[model samples]
Target: MSNSTPQKFEFQTEIKQLLDIVIHSLYTEKEIFVRELVSNASDALEKLRHTQLTEKEVFDDNLTLEINVTTDDKAKTITIQDFGVGMTREELVENLGTIAHSGSKAFLQALGESGAKNSNLIGQFGVGFYSAFMVAKSVKVYTHSWRKDAPGHMWSSDGSGTYEIEEAEGQRRGAKIVIELKDDCADFAQDWKIKEILERYSAFVSFPINLNGKRINTVQALWLRNKNEVKDEEYTEFYKFQAHAFDEPRLRLHFSADAPLAINALLFVPKENTEKLGFSRLEPSVSLYCRKVLIDAKPKDILPEWLRFLKGVVDSEDLPLNISRETMQDKSLLEKLNKVITKRFLKFLEEEAKNRAEGYTEFYKEFGVFLKEGAALDFTHKDQLVKLLRFESSLTEKGKTTSLADYVSRMGADQKEIFYLVGPNRASIESGPYLEGFKARNLEVLFCYETVDEYVMNNVREFDGKKLTAADHADVKLADLPKPEGALKDEDVTTLTKWLKDTLGERVSEVKPSDRLVDSPVIALNADKFMSPHMRRIMKAMNKDAETPLRVNLEINPRHAVIKRLFETHTAQPEKAKLVAEQLLDNALISAGLLDDATAMVARLNKLLESV
Candidate 1:
């Protein structure tokens, strides 16, 4: 009994289940074992760094605080060593052998709750040290405590349900994990393989990381750096390295928040939108970090879906991470982070739109569709997003665009609604009869070109207290223009309207003399307040046999020559007048994009030609 022998210990039930899950399924990528172990070593070094300020007569005080990785492909082994606060035999039994005695969890909670303003806190789960078993056939950890009188010890495990601990000599002041790689997992022992994994997940570790005697994490954590001191080239390099992007960023917002939650974020808008170039939809790229250590490279709910195009890093010391640190634990805290960052980014866009109008116009040409999607779908930021929307209008030039705020500023005091018209292009919208009324009264109308514009406007509803009204909507009522000379008399106009209604019957909801029209003979507006021409087109696109029967109000321009002649022809020759009336209505229907079959209109035109 006097002779020293290794003492064996059995893992708790929870520890066994956790070990199996971590080795097999907890982490999707096997290479993360390196990251997890490196992170643990970094945390141990950080604790020693903090402990030195308070304690005197520490063990191995002269040891450098850095991590060293020595990979041996011949022996199929990877060894990670750190010179920090090591563990005692009793400490090892409690931390490594017990399920709930996690030093990282207690340390991180203290760091967060204390608000000590240190960025070295890394691991959250106490089980991160066990992640080495994922690729290790056998693992040995040699550690020496900081207390000068404590003896060195070695803990060895095959990860087959039992572990053994015994005294060891010549151990360093901190922990050294020696992993014997399995046959299939031998690649982890290669120099290039471990280096790549280190750069991807642990590049931002507060402590220096060396792989096979070569320094790997040379890039600084720029998000934590002060903006005034950070150079543009530094940000560019960080963006390229962090986002894996080649081109320079189009826009960048580096900000920190403490109110709703403590957060430091550096977000970038890339020069090109890959989705616009017909690439697959982008996944989230804003990596989530805690104290410079990578947590999740692509967190789904870290930001809103609309901000998925953004690339950069978001670090929050306040995060209440789960045991794996792979997924967030508090969803409400995550939502708060999302709202704060999204609002800040939207504010950045608003500034860009105002301060650099030309540059923003170029950006809008490429990425504005995303903003429109958010405006319609994200209710929390809809108003701010709506304000950022730019569109060509009746008053704007061919390529120029105006914002809703700008449109409202140009509105007359008598104007009560913000008017917009949806069409294929500016040419089609300007040439349409619906624009004639607005043009005559010197009123401007926004020109919407995309099919989604209708949906966006319908969902946005209003902006800045002014209702967003489609100019072609059936409910629109324009102010009366002065009556022109040689126009049809009041009685004649009334008689023509009644005759047209009677002849058109159910095809027309009601016929009326135009108070808004100036030169156009007729313009059709949808009678169903809910359905616009764009809505009808959307319905037809969804279902081929969808019934889009026309139900519209027909307005006749009393001053137009065609209508004056039609009134005279109505009484002189009722038979011919009916054909002309039907043809005129069909022309208006064609303009509204509601004419289903052109065969009837072609036949009617031929009959009228015969009469001529």
Candidate 2:
């Protein structure tokens, strides 16, 4: 160290303006300074690592390549030391005192042109290092050039207007920034505060980060690694760490993409769905990272709302963040990113369903609601999401599931539409009249148990070129089967339907002989094309005032014993037959989950018992 005297220099005009903006308005959160500084240190280390491959004679060759953060609450001081490529005296003047190489000149120009409200432009210009002035009272940068002959120097600034530089002794090969914390920002000097900030934003930095001699970033960025080399246990551990979850992941998708946008994503489906377990609605848990540095912990636009159940990380190097690195500047690019990740995840599900049927079935049982939501709402991925949907069908064993594609493949050439029935469970759906004719004809029908299943079906509308038809809908048309022995004649069936419609009055929209019923006495189909019985019930449960009046197309099976008896009793015992007709409509309503009041049915049943 030759010069004992310090040399002073004034900051450039742009630097002076930048200091004011950064100190007062650049970042919304004051603690972002720590992330900015740490990110810069990691960048320097990465550059040095690349340089090490070519240069043999590096200064301080024995120093470990790591970042150490020390905090002293007693003295209100925090120091960040990184053993990476440092700067010389002239380089410090060029880097810190002027706006030439730092891109501050352009940043200032853009800031002035667009005004402070348009701050997203700040990120396009590199000004990360100056973010430290947000909380620092006085900043001291002690650095030594990586070149062997370069001397150590200390650059001091209070970020007012000017700075001083002086030769120093015993400085390391890299930069060490000591920040004298302002009185209002003294919390930053606390060990716990810094540790929290580091773990939140800098946890996945390529270089090791140590806070107060304890490692902060221990978990690796598994998304960026080759899938074949990563162990299953490692994935589980990473999922638990990233998701803050205890149970092992039910499914994991770790993938990388180069085209469209360079992206690396590690997504996990938790072992249990918390929302299904009666927990509060899930928020978006998949965090967004830019080059391994966390940009947003819960980025709302990163994924569709239906994918809120997923937990993990999505890191892309192509992201251009604003000055605070808090939000992305290019919205179209972000949308492209969303499309890519969503399509890739849906593709991953397709592969899982094809190659690992049992495991996919287990995942579907827990997380299938989310896929259904996506299938109903996200039109961009509806085809793929619909393909990933699983359902128990009349053809499959209990608890077994089939994909839409598989269901389509099993369909006979004569079948023109996909058939499904919604009820409380497999037993209710099987016992219901809606599935009888399909079962009699050996036609498979999907059994939907959840309330959302109807809405999903209604929105998805069609899959694999076949219309998704509700078996209970009045519009359904089934092929005729051979008339069973002892069935009502066509003339008697028409007369019975007309008499029942007159007896039931407005309760029945239109009574007719059914082709979609084989053994059941009668079935109630919703008359309204827009609202099904199940959907009406759902609306009533949510808001009673929202419920609409019920109108049904009652279809009676001509071949069933009850219908034959009703046909016979209509003219002989008219009052007794009226009671039977009312009771049958109520019974069908009960099976369809459309019954609002049973008082009338109870009184009618008493009258019928008296007549018997």
Best by lDDT: 2
Q: What is candidate 2's lDDT per residue for 56-173, written digit by digit as tens? A: 8889978888999999999999999998889999999998888767889877766665566545334335576788898999999999888889999999999999999999999998
Q: Model 1 misses residue 261 by how many Å?
A: 1.8
lDDT of each: 0.83, 0.85
Note each model's CA RMSD in angstroms. Answer: 11.8, 13.3
Cα error, residue 542 of model 1, in Å, equals 1.5
Q: Give the local distance difference test score of model 2.
A: 0.85
Q: Write the per-residue lDDT of candidate 1 for residues 434-508, one digit (tens) a residue.
A: 999999898999999998899999999999999999998778999987888989999999999999999999999
The segments of candidate 2 whose C-alpha lies over 4 angstroms from its true place after superposition are 1-220, 321-327, 545-547
